[model samples]
Target: MCHSQDRTPSEVGRDLVQWFLENQRDLPWRRDYSPYGVWVSEIMLQQTQVAAVVPYYLRWMKRFPDVPSLAAATEDEVLLYWEGLGYYSRARNLLKAARLVMERFGGRVPDTEADLRVLPGVGPYTASAILSLAYNRDVPVVDGNVERVAARLLDLDVSAKSPEGRREVLRAATQWLVPGKARFYNQALMELGAVICTPAHPKCLACPVAARCLALRHGTVENRPVRSPRPRWEELRVAIGVLRENGKIYIQKRPEGGLFAGLWEFPGGKALEAETPRVALVREMEEELGVRVKIVDKIGVVRHAYTRFRVTLHAYRCVPDPPGQIVRPRACAAWKWVRPSELDLFAFPAANRRLIQALRKAADAGS
Candidate 1:
């Protein structure tokens, strides 16, 4: 941990920007340097893959279109758009930030990282990215990709899981910043880390900054950076897929406080001991939907991964002998009987998205 003040943040910023101008990848967010676009993309990118995010981003931008639109939207609406993306908290935060922008900043996004940090869910990396990219401020954006790149490039043996370790990595990355070209430099470093200096196999030879990389030169690109122990695995038994009536889906809105909040989901909960998944679905639907459903057929099973747990989603196609009127549970705000054609308007979980396709296929096949 050397704090050589000799390497000014501005000088390093300039070099990185020069590298960025020639190497930066063309991403949608890069098309326009606006805080609204940056804010949306950064929030969407949280814990989500770029490939998965592309369609969502496009659809989201089309729907909201601007900061004022997002700010004016309801929580349920925001969650609907962000459905299937997981981590509903990010959607909640986006709304909060948008409202703050409207109220505190005259509906205009802030330009400084400090002011941006005060908004909900805008942490150090997001703040830096918004400031540097949208405002051309000289700040280092150290995301997971940037962290991996920096740690391996410098061959630093620090625990990435710890606060102090993260701070050191951020400091090191900022030391390499290229001043006036903050946006390009930050995006370039991110792209290089994402495409070339990957976790499993790094194409060191193809890396532009390989000559200055201590890890590449010393043959420690793969094994240089060490992290804390892997995340603990937890198992979740989730009951899903609320099938009701003829060719209609029954969905319950999630509470606005926890994971999957505000999103529409099939009414089912965790299966208990001595309780089969089907039985659990029956009980949960009754509890959550105020309707009793008899398990007609098991659609299929789905395996989904969350940030903290692995879920085994048991999807079943059930029918109510005498359909009870759709009602919202205490945890839910509303219920909807959405036709298959209009399923796109409602937010669903990722795994359940595939399940819906399967259901449609089953219906088409007269199953």
Candidate 2:
């Protein structure tokens, strides 16, 4: 029973599960009840769209089908498969979780939500998701969609924008979860939000429980998920592009620390105060690659967000002027010039992929 004096969660839970059976999407993870499969899908789903995750999930499942397989895979190989999927930390955490499962649980994923949370990178939401979706356990799994749906249902005024506000919403959502049938119930609410109960112009008429929805009844569905105004993000001047020659693009592998480490990337860095992009590029190349480059044409710019900072990467196609032997100076592990066709052999950041695309276009135009 829900501790809150509101309506019993059991009835709501039953309605949701009943609705889900008739409207659930045929996701790959749902086809099987393997905890490893569910865990991989959940991790891949974090900060990634479902449409985008489909191929990656399928490829990853084929490559590393189980916890033991994932545990046996090298980090480089795992990152190769995970290329273009931002937030490299999630991939690293997946490996850590697999290793933990192999060593402690004899390569078996734990079924209980509490036990699942103890694994590296397994949070409250992820643990609950795995427990309910994979193991058919009763646990409150509140993701963004679930949060939005729950917020609209209860007409919660608390800010879901801030970190603390989001936490508060999680607590409220957990209070409304029905014990012992959380699997289908949680999935149903999530599905409803993903399809009909969208962020804007929700199909209230098609909602299963629209007649009982507090937001719809009160005409506040659009604004029910309240939040404080976002702070102005600090801007960064970034440099990114390929150093090219003879159909080979120069790339350097980042060190095993910081963002996108142990991954191949275009040689670029942040511009210091009042520094020109060319100056920054030259300095960064010298510092990171121990080589000199002659700036060519400005390729383009890519706008990206990383944590708290908003960055505008100024891309430029350049050529190594000095043509010196590449050296891995400062925070770099290795350097190489690889053809575009073989780029998949190494893991690269999204920005690097964009750089490669731009370089290929340049090569085609030059030809």
Q: Give the candidate number with the greatest lDDT.
A: 2
Candidate 2's C-alpha runs over 4 A off are: 1-8, 161-179, 244-248, 325-328, 337-340
Per-residue lDDT, model 2, residue 97, is 86
State the displacement of the C-alpha of residue 156, model 2, in Å, after optimal TM-score superposition. 1.3
User: What is candidate 2's lDDT per residue for 102-194, written digit by digit as tens?
Assistant: 888999899877678878889988988888888777667777788788778777666565566676666656665667667777788889889
Model 1, 1-367: lDDT tens per residue?
3223333456555655666777776778879877899889988998988888888998999999888999999887887888878887888899998899999999888887678998999998888889888988887788888887777766676665467668777877777776576788888778877888888888887776676676776677777557667789889887875576867777766666766666777777899878888888888877866777778889988898877789898999888857655554656767778787877777777777778888888889995
Reference-based TM-score, model 1: 0.89
TM-scores for every predicted model: 0.89, 0.89
- Global Cα RMSD, each model: 2.9, 3.0
Candidate 2 CA-lDDT value: 0.80
